[model samples]
Target: MKVVIAIDSFKGSVTSLEGSAAIAAGIRSVYPDAEIISLPVADGGEGTVEALVTASGGRFVSLEVTGPLGQPVAAAYGLLGDGRTAVIEVAAVCGLPLVPEAARNPLHTTTFGVGEMIAGAMRQGVRDFIIGLGGSSTNDAGTGMLQALGYRFLDKDGQDVGRGGAALLDIHSIDAAGALTGLQACRFRIACDVDNPLYGPEGAASIFAPQKGADEEAVRLLDRGLRQWATAAADLTGSDIASVPGAGAAGGLGAAFVGLLGGTLESGIGVALEMIELDRHLEGAQLVITGEGKLDGQTSRGKVPYGVAQLARKRDIPVIALAGSVDHGAEALNDHGITAYFPIVNGPMSLEDAMDPAGTRYRLQATASQLLRLLRAAGRL
Candidate 1:
């Protein structure tokens, strides 16, 4: 029997690799001769860098970079085993969690640290980049990041416009003359899932700014600034960035990557699965196991389990998902390629106890063993 285990991290509890090991151990208890392939996976959000790096035998590079509020923050990026590929999660630098609720205004946040991270990786001879655009606290449309990369956003008087969403409205021109020379030789693959535009009613500010600490008035101001920035960027790059799908993700940082950095935006899970080469490992697997911390309506939207199921479905393999908690909408996953879904919790317990790493591992192992026992009795193992 062959089994492929690819589970995502359980947030504060078990990690992807750890969860996979637990599942594998359970399977081994039932079928000791089973060939188990464990792969670490993430949804291209917070744990992206760690998952990809650990799975690919990569190293992490940590540095102090400017935070969203112009203060110093410790940040890190991943250098893959390939020696040339660097994976960066925007959340690691300017994510909302890094800012307190009282200080979470998008107008004052910046992505300068994201650019600094890229520059730092470039200095290490990394030319290929996989950037995850999620959990950002800025609505600067990448101006702050662009500024750090040498693309100057200037006021009408030709002075530097400075950082944050507040600076977007003051921009009169964009100067690419001083931009990093090596940027032309680099290739960027952006992991993005949202499709909001750059500005307007359905755009970045209007849709996502409120959660980043913007009120109605701040949303209006940020939207106006985004519009102005989009126009200036169009004048410079000659591309209508405002209309691009996912151009509004991560508080308009997606626009900077796709419009200014010449990066291509793709589904976050698709990018993650491609990096891990999930298909290659699924070749002759009889059973595939995948899951995450939770399974809900959002799981079908470019998440780890959904991505794995789709690939397994192509090969006619039975895919089972194991999550810490299963919500009402998780049943919808059955139509999307998941053969079955199971929750690891055995009985009623506190949420904290359920999330305990050792407890999660034990429950996962027990569940897998029982599932395998059922399959064996049914002559399906």
Candidate 2:
């Protein structure tokens, strides 16, 4: 039997690679002769850089860059096997995790490190970019990133503006005279799942700022600042990015890419699958097994398992999904090309105990073995 395993991370328990290995172990225990191909995958978020880089036989390049707080931080970007494609996760440079809860403040955070990472990749002659826009700690409308790239955000006095979202409120003129010239030669494909706009009730600050440590008053102020920058960005780029879908992602970094760099916003899973060439690996496969930390109605919204199943269905291959726990609405995934779903949890156990790496590995192996045994009994093997 030819089976392809492409599991996502189990989050805090096992990585995608580890999950795939566990499943493969189970398959081997039952059918030692079966051909099992393990592929680690992600939806272009937390594990995006590592997933893409590792799967493509790429390497990571680390450097010091400005953090969300204007402090120096060590950041890394990926160079894929193609040698021309670079994968960058904005979160790596200024993600929320880098900031303590007490210090989280979208108003004062910046995306300068994001720009620095892109520039670093460019310096290596990488012109094709896959930028993951999630888990940000800033709402700067990407001015910080623009600044790092040589775009100048000028106040009424022609003085350069300071970092943070609130700073965008100053009457401004965006000066591109010093912007990186090599930017014109690059192609940027942004990994974005959300569709929030730049400013307004459903915009970045209003919907996401609170989680980034902004209070009600700060949200309002940041929203107002975003509106100001939107108007200015529109005047400078001739594009009303404030209203664009996904323009609010990563605190307006999406706007900077779409409005200024001409990047395309696409589903994170789609971008990830495309980068890994998942379709090519599905050929002639009897079955495809995939999983995530949790499977729910939300999985249908472009998660890794859903993406893998969709592609597998196109080739008429049966797909089985494994999860830590399958929630009520997860049954809905059956209609989305997943032939069956199973949880790795064997029986009663605390959430913490179940998440132990060694325990998870054993459970996954046992589950896969039993699944194969059942298939054999049904004469499907």
Candidate 3:
């Protein structure tokens, strides 16, 4: 029998690779001769770099970069084994968690570090980029990042407008003369899931800036700044990026990538699945096991388990999901491709205890063992 295990990280407990190994061990106990293929997976969020790098036998490159508040912070990106591809997560540098709640204000935050990461990768001869746009702490319409990449945002006086969302309001023209010479040779594949536009009521600033520390008045100011930046950007790029779907993701980083750099925005999970070549490994697989930290109504929306199950469904393979916890809305997953879903916890336990790495690994093994035992008893193994 052949089995494929592609589970996501259990958040603070276990990583995707570790979880897959534990589950694989349990299945091996049931059928020692079974063939198992383990793949680490993520949905272009926090663990994207780790999942993609580890699965592809890639290496990580760490560097000191400017943080959201203009302070230096340690960050890392992945260089895939293929040598030409580099994977970066915006959250690694300017994510909300990096800022204190009292200090969380989108007006002052910046994505300059994101640009530094990309520039570091470029220095390594990496031309193919897979950038994950999620968990950002800024609403600068990507002007800060653009500034770091050699694009100058000039005020009406033709002076540099400086960094941060507030600077957007002072921009008058964009100067691309100083941009990195090798940038035109680079290709960016942006992993994005949100469809919020650049500005306005349903746009990036109005919808996401609040969570990044913007109050009511700040939201209004940031929204106005985004609108001004959008107009200026459109004039330079000749594209109306403000209205494009997902142009507001990661605080308008999506606009900078898609509108300025000519990157393509795609579903996060879809990009992950393609990067790992999940389809090639699914060939002839009789069973597939996939899951994440939790299973809920949102699981069907481009998450790891949902993406895995969709592919398995097409191949007529049964998919079993093993989650850290299962919520009420998770039952809806049955209609989306999951044949069955199970929570790893055997009994009641504190949230902290349940998140213990060793404990979670043991539970995963125990749960997987029983699941396989059941299949054997049903004459389905």
What C-alpha lDDT do the candidate models reach, one value each?
0.92, 0.91, 0.92
Worst 10 residues of 3 by lDDT: 140-149
Clashes of 1: 0
TM values, all candidates: 0.98, 0.98, 0.98
Residues 1-381, candidate 3, lDDT per residue (tens digit)?
999999989999999989999999999999999999999989999889998998799999999999999999999999998999999999999999999999999999999998988888899999999999999999998888878889999999999997888898898888999998799999999999999999899998889998888989998988888888888888998989999999999999999999989999999999999999999999999899999999999999889999999999999899999999999889988998899999998888999999999999999998999999999999998
- TM-score, candidate number 3: 0.98
Q: Please provide, for model 2 over 1-381, each residue's C-alpha lDDT reduced to its tens digit, 9 standing for 90 to 100.
A: 899999899989989888888889889887899999888889989889889998899999999999989899998899999899999998999999988889999989999998998888889998999999999999998899989999999888999899998898884789988989799999999999999999899999999999999999999999999988988888898877888899999888889999988899999999988878889989988889999989998999999999999999999998999999999789888999999999989889998998999988888888888998898788887
Per-residue error for 152 in candidate 1, Å, reads 0.7
Pairs clashing within candidate 2: none
